[model samples]
Target: MVKLIHTLVDHSDDVNYCAFSSSCLASCSLDKTIRLYSLNNFIELPYSPLKGHTYAVHCCCFSPSGHILASCSTDGTTMLWDTHNGQTLAVLKQPHGSPVRVCRFSPDSTYLVSGAADGSIVLWNVQSLKLYRSGSVKDGSLVACAFSPNGNLFVTGSSCGDLTIWDDKMRCLYNEKAHDLGVTCCDFSSHTVSDGEQGSRYFRMASCGQDNQIKLWLISFVDFLGCELKYECTLNGHTAPVLACAFSYDGQMLVSGSVDKSIIIHDTKTRSILHTLTQHTRYVTTCAFAPDIPLLATGSMDKTVNIWQFDPKQHCTGSLLEDEPKMSVENWSEEEVSVWLCAQGLKDLVGIFKMHNIDGKELLSLTKHSLTNDLKIESLGLRTKVFRKIEELRIKVDSVSLGIPDEFLCPITRELMKEPVIAADGYSYEKEAMENWISKKRRSSPMTNLPLHSLVLIPNRTLKMAINRWLETQQKYNETT
Candidate 1:
């Protein structure tokens, strides 16, 4: 079961949208205000309240960098606010005759998109506060719009269940019936690679609707044939309307929140229900996952936003205990069994990563160090200098040994000592071959070096005490000004 770390109650009205940053969460509500909450202290009042919307705020989103917020309201206006100071930056009045339902910033943060009840979608130049292009869909109101992860394509879903894809030039590329009922929310998956499968270099879109279904589509750009879009798969598990849907960083798991008062995790390839999370007491209106963290946040009409931790161990189970109960007990010593059990327990970690918005892309990657790794400046400063020297030495050594230029090396695989793991020979190693060998040795030996720490069982308490002392010494460091 997932647990909530804290519950924040501030909005007297229904929270229409909730977005998270590294240190804060921004929520807009029908109370005609946007509130910013510091995650570290939820009991404290919001760090600031942004009040400008005259009517109910429909949607609010943080920019990729978390520095700016864009919100749409029923007052037929979209406003941009400075997140740091709670100051309104710009206000854009609707050119059409309807309330703005959705507003989002482009992946590059250079433009903003807003969809309204008047069946119109407008793009604005954020820096200049100038309107870029205004496009109209047929018959129904535009309910949702999302910019593709690559920023080349943008899509809009209508109340009539029609999905339209547009290029940067505002040309309509693909138009199709996406759902039976009104489309409520849409998201695009970023480029990702998992296990061995690589996601599309472009972008894949996920859309949820009142039809009680979530649909995934592949978007492709064609020079000669124009833009070609194809329906990939349909995920069906929700009993009521699916209000929001988002793809995980790895693109293997897709999460959808519904009016059924449940959140469902779906395997994108098989379309199987992996987990059904039932915690929300009311209709879920919005849901989003942290790009770098294994955390998910959802807001519902129940006047609460829930934070969930994604536990990977709930999905993977090993059969070592089932096949050989006696052998498993006899062949492995108590210390070995303890290590195995610890590994199994570690698998249940909340997989969260450090996220950075760079060059308009949300880069999700592992944190630089372990959770227990201290930020002691004395220890860390020396390590940082050593790392720089090592990098310089590595470049010099490579220039002398390998005839290939440094420019030709693949940036993704160039760095050594990237992720340290144990070798079969029981020594720590940084090469990929060492990791492969350790995986094979794990079938017999209970000991393996993890990314965080190296663990071993000692025969004597004295040895354990000595190791603990060494760890304490490493952790004790004074910061030098």
Candidate 2:
């Protein structure tokens, strides 16, 4: 049975997107802001109404660690903010200056990809917020994007009715005409379907569109050189244009919202309707499933977000929180450490770990010297291996601490800008590089390939000051390290 737990009626305009982390829920709206809520009691967080965007906020997503939140807007910029304090971390401007419609973080949270209305896609390195790669589709307002569970591939859907697949390097892997009218939204299932082989795996993806239909696809990552996308089936449960769709954390159920003012839940395995809810009075725009709980959030044009709870037994056989409690490795007990060691193929180390009473805190603090001196490991290879694993764990536990600031590098030289200059194209570049290009009779912007309206270049003193501050901070950090 499905039960409505709470209704959030805070937004004054149409809600565009909604997302859930393990501890918080975020929703963005046409009111030009994003709101945060605590999952404990569905109370609005103090960081609610993040107001950096100049226009309507279209989409928002939480990183894998939930320490960072990304929101894209009609202002042609995607901003990353500290989820805990609502402080702006970085602002990434679209190259074409088109309104960004969607943004998603890779499974590993190493990369952030944003899609613009001009069909442009920019992949940003999350650590430094530098532009990693940029590409454009043939035609369409890029509307939807989702990363595969494995983080090796991502798929984007456009208003031109095309679904295109891309790799980590932003290379086009596959493209297909998915919907006749226009694709509104798409999502990849969280779980992978094994083909009874050690390496072969197939992922199920769902896409809903203006055609009033949802299509299922079987995506194969079996071969990196030649990925495949095969049509599985079509779901026609919604009566009107389906705006949003998402797979549950367990991948056993799929939910979608549509212009029919209703939400539909489907049994993905049986391809049958489990429930149909008509609680919203207007078009339902977005929906999401909590990663750790049996809760579902749906947003609508009625300017409200409804949170629902589903019985775990009715949807799946196992408990929903079975694998979710280990989210905070820092809070793990000594016994949990032993189990983790065995799972990491280091069963031999579990005995030593238990003897030393090594819990999550101890594991995170293990360095090469500690592993050799404290743990009394003489073998160089084994000590290096243990230290490496611990470092990886540290990264997963607190990745936000590793990232710095953004857009401090010149797009032309791909280096830190010494004398920043703003051209007519509205992008900052190294003054020397821009002057050299202008002197060489190049009357176009190096980044945009568009004609330069004038040769006059304006000095960006603000950017120069920001870069200097960052340099000073880095110098101090290096000295301390």
Candidate 3:
């Protein structure tokens, strides 16, 4: 079933990288040029070669949706190209002050991440093709980068032989000394694999290095230690340094390209080689699997690109998540909870939580309390309507599912607060609602009826965060429900 369908030899020099979109193949080369080929006919597109870089183009990546292609070069520039007509969309000059080594698109296709010889990683917004953020992995150059399927995590491999996993906030979640030699390539699965022991489902990550091995990993939640990444297994069949690895759309097959000019396709479950492709005469540097197809693309230093196809369909079977995993709210900080609340547009809930010292984990108990007697919540004037809304949200009506948790609902207007603020008497209310209460209605506390000490409403940042976490949890359950 393994067959080379086409060989594209448009590059005048060594091809550094290659990628497969749904309709096209893109390759960058040491000729300081980028090229596109149509997968339908296996011929170069009418635009042919795109020339702009002053030095060798080191890497190129197609966004998940196949809308944009990103290329980085030794010219110290990264360019975004419109994949349709081969026009430059945007250009970033001297992002790293050295050769841009690699670039990748986030699983969601909303972000583009590029790594360079200067040890810097820059994230670009795909829509605007503008820089979103940038950071350094270490003093050593970043050679490879990947984003988890959930879009919550990413991993970068540095020349110093370390692999660092980071969260959406760019916080290092885990770091591993993966290989004795610099890691040459890394990729994430399109599907998640379950950690049979922890009963956890997580994306599988594979990294190949100068050590001639491919390492597999998964992010798992451990009981006392919180979230952790576990090393799963290793495959070692390549005779020389493995330069690239990619997971099939279904995540059942793992493909590795080596300096020995051989590509090994391993069954991920058995860690056994299923096929060995020796069609390239020089070191194979890059490879990619089309997200929903059987096609695989690989490039070599031999200045050629090969498109290989398998007979069997390689689409994801279904979701790997059987049960929604719980994120620990026991240690969630107040600020974190507040952020969630704000994101959910429920700032009014913060006051009630603070008035009662509510932790996000205590939501079940909070639900047990009815609207009639929940610690003087409804007594507040504007808050009465908010509590009413909470009562309505707790139940699934004839069609609508259970909405946000009752406690997170704003007390002033009986809706999710647009801007939550704390009034003087330690009760949370919508800032606008409170303003109306004091100015239009009366100059007294809605709940206490005491003269207003101060109208200053402190933002309930912690509650906002809790609201966000809660929403995410609910959404996850809804998917698997």
Top-TM-score candidate index? 2
Native-vs-model 1 lDDT? 0.66
lDDT of 1 by residue, 4-79 (tens): 6666577788878887777677778888988787665644333467888899998988888888889899999999
The runs of at least 3 residues in candidate 3 whose Cα sits more than 4 Å from the true structure, single-residue gaps closed, are: 94-96, 221-227, 313-481
> Candidate 2, which ten residues in sequence have the lowest lDDT sum?
317-326
Q: Judged by lDDT, which candidate is best?
A: 2
> If scored against the real structure, what TM-score would every candidate get?
0.63, 0.65, 0.63
Tens digits of per-residue lDDT for model 2, 1-481: 6779999999999999999999999999999999999999999998788999999999999999999999999999999999989999999999978999999999999999999999999999999999999999999899999999999889999999999999898999899888989999999998987543245678989999999989988788644466888666677556589999999988988889999888878778756556667789999999999998889999999999999997766555322221223447777888888766644445578888888889888888887877877888888867776776576567445433434343666766546788999999777889999999899999976754547899889999998999888878878998999
Candidate 3: how many backbone clashes? 19
The TM-score of candidate 1 is 0.63
Q: Give per-residue lDDT, candidate 2, residue 466.
A: 92
Model 2 TM-score relative to the real fold? 0.65
Q: What is the C-alpha lDDT profile of model 3 across 1-481, one tens digit per residue?
A: 4678888888889988888888888889999999988877888888868878889999888887788888999888888888778898888764637788888888788777878888888887778877888888765888999888877778999888888877655666677788788898899888887765457688788999999889888765333354566666678667689999998877888889999888878778756456667789999998888765678888999999898887563232221111112244444455544543332234567766566665544432344244346655554533444443334323312112446554465655656665667778667777788888877857666643446777667987777777778768988998998
Better model by TM-score, 1 or 2? 2
